[model samples]
Target: MGMDNKMIVSSSPHIRSIESIQSVMTDVLIALFPVALMAVLLFGYQALITMVISVATAMLVEALWLRKRDIYNDGSAAVTGLLFAMVLPPSPPWWLVVVGSAAAIIIGKQVFGGIGYNIFNPALVGRAVVLVSWGGYMAGNIWSPPQPFAFGADVAAVTGATALADQGEAIQYKLSDFFIGNVPGCLGETSALALLIGGIWLYYRGHIDWRIPGGYIGTVFIMGAVFGGGFYDNHLMTGLFHVLAGGVMLGALYMATDMVTTPVTPAGRLIFGIGCGLITMLIRLWGVLPEGVTYAILLMNAVTPIIDNFTVPKQFGGVNKSA
Candidate 1:
């Protein structure tokens, strides 16, 4: 009876779950598979090449640097590599793929103390570095135009500016085109349908919540409708365009919702998403860049800790205001 009455304490880590890091990474990779497949179907062999190179180099770098015999089993490097490739222009030279993958693992992940310790998303860190270093390759006519549903066919060598880059009287894309990925942009970001499929998969697995993306996409829709061109004639259409075009869909779902970089509290997550949208729109409109998802999410990532600190809920039974 005394033994039962006494408090029982086991060693640390008593609570456990079936989920493992490998399982989580595997799910993310699986979710990414359709998007990656769409990238290949639209952009052709160049996309496949870039993905392979990035994955290989990222895994190699991580294993060599850490001297981990089973680094591949952890599955972080593969996810980072695939993500880095997804954000890049599909037609980059082989050397660029190697360089960016190495940078992602070395500077982005390991330099910040690896995996969970990195402040910014590791994949975005690599992409930002590559973009800054080789602006000509990353933007300004480097994008390979998507060939609509032309799977297993020869991808014609064509280059075009993205829909977001066209700030004339109006952007030159229908909602259907964006949905079907008949546009020019990064390999993975062009297809709204693909991204939604992946995001839905993640959501179904209970890996993500809608709040981050909901706040992000909602803010962009609202802001674009108010300040965007052609809103007077077609407010609803204009709002839909902003939501469908460019990297907003991909960024809101995949990049901004990164578990390690985003906030822990619900309010903080919403605020983070809103901040990302605000910065993204500002850069897209006033700033020189046509797309701002990368920098916006990265900037918000830098402030996640502060957001969490202030937004943390009060303890369960203590500090009652009406006590």
Candidate 2:
């Protein structure tokens, strides 16, 4: 009897998809390429260099922290690195890149027990830390104006504010320029067209659901029309501007939809998105800062577990307690 072997049984969900962490992360990198390409095209080779340095730094930090030689091969560190870089101003110094990358992997991700266990989005955490630590590079007088493929020393040395940064009525950007990504801003926030292309590609591949982005953007559009842009040109353009102007497109499509830190249930996802939109507009309209996508999404990420608990659906054959 002691020599007899017994089969071990495990929990149901006994089934699984063929997809691995590597494949999903690879798809995310592919989706981000259009935005990265647009960043380089608008900002110059310096933008590309920042992205490379950030990615390398993230991979190195994660490898060293976890003592896992294959960490880079998972593609997660690369995704975090690029996402972190996309949010930075064009051509920040190499030290900022290294520091933010390490913080993202070590503090933001690994400290929370890595990947699936993290409460906040690691890239956003990294960005928030760096933005606070080095406000000069993130804001103030360090931004390089878009050069549009000009890689020479023709880079703009003078500091300038983004359109949102200038809250005055006399903002100088043409709507077309912002849409096509000609204005100066963070590497990813400048181009709505590029982000949309990448977002659509991700959606078509079934990598993301429509509910989260739909809720977040729909709420923003409504709020913008109700509160912003004087009624002159049908007011729709004003609403469109809110969606296109800053990181709304990037946040709604990519960061807010992070599967690891967001809700799993459909209704919960909608609530999470709406909550993000509400917080973002509140900050943009009334808070001191011009943009609020990063903090808004991170806040909602902190609430995702609660959202899931409240939004859990009833079982197929279960009767309501009150019934």
Candidate 3:
């Protein structure tokens, strides 16, 4: 028989696609453009500086780790860097951005053998590290209020608290401000409108699934509505406020929907999302922290393998061995 006619066997991932890692990461960057643009528009020059430092530091660290001159290797480092920036305050000290970004690429990703092998989201890991190591810089009532259209303004001089915080002064902002991202918060998480636009773009590109995001956002809304105590106008509005404010929009639409560091089975994905939302609300409403997206998602990431194992579909036409 000719070589063309012979059958050849391969490993488990026999399926193939036209998409490459570079192409996928490129799409993710494109989707993130609206968020980054909104961040710059909302927080001005300092936001731009923070992002540049983060992306640059992440790429530099990854390049040095691989001993390659090409810093943009597969674009994963860039993505991880940008995501890390999104979670940070608009005007954190430059050293903080550099340390967190480097730690993200090194400890969060490279230590796990790189790229597809990482069990936790690198960006969240970086955020968690900084939050724990330097709580003064990462948390509290130090958030800079957004100076929309003031590209040259010094936003860091005007500090405030986020809506999610327990401070009574933080509750003054309207829901409209939260939706349009005029309120004070993290660099990329303030604008629910921009995040929704990016989420739509990602969904269009088939980079995410509805099960995770839908379940996440839905559970958050339901829990907030039932238990939120009608502080923001009404229970429904409080639920809406919870969904619009903080990092829920960014986390539900981007982080929790990560292709890696999440479950593969359909049921497992939904369960993972719900678990994240539940833990997030538990922390936000009762725990010491005001925001919980980072730790919530990280906790769920730790149990992904178990979720998949329990939810995996049985092979078709297979009989039970016990029988």
For each candidate, how many residue pairs have backbone atoms clashing (under 3 Å)? 0, 0, 0
**Residue 63's lDDT in candidate 2:** 86
Residues 1-323 of candidate 2 have per-residue lDDT tens digits of 75587766799888899888889999999999999999989988888898999999999898888888886678888999999998898878889989998898888899989888899999999999899998888883346668887875445475577766664421466678878888878888789899989999889878888888998998887777777663324467667677777789899998998889999988899999899888888887788988889999999999999999888876789765211
Q: For each candidate in the order shown, give its overall lDDT on alpha carbons.
A: 0.85, 0.84, 0.90
Which 10 successive residues of model 2 have the least lDDT summed?
228-237
Residue lDDT tens for model 1, 169-231: 225666788887878888888889989999999999888898899999998888788767654
Question: With candidate 3 superimposed using the best TM-score fit, by how many Å does residue 106's alpha carbon deviate from the native?
Answer: 0.9
Identify the leading candidate in terms of TM-score. Answer: 3
- Model 3 steric clash pairs: none
RMSD of each: 3.9, 3.4, 3.0
Model 1 ranges with Cα > 4 A deviation: 1-9, 12-15, 149-156, 168-170, 231-233, 317-323
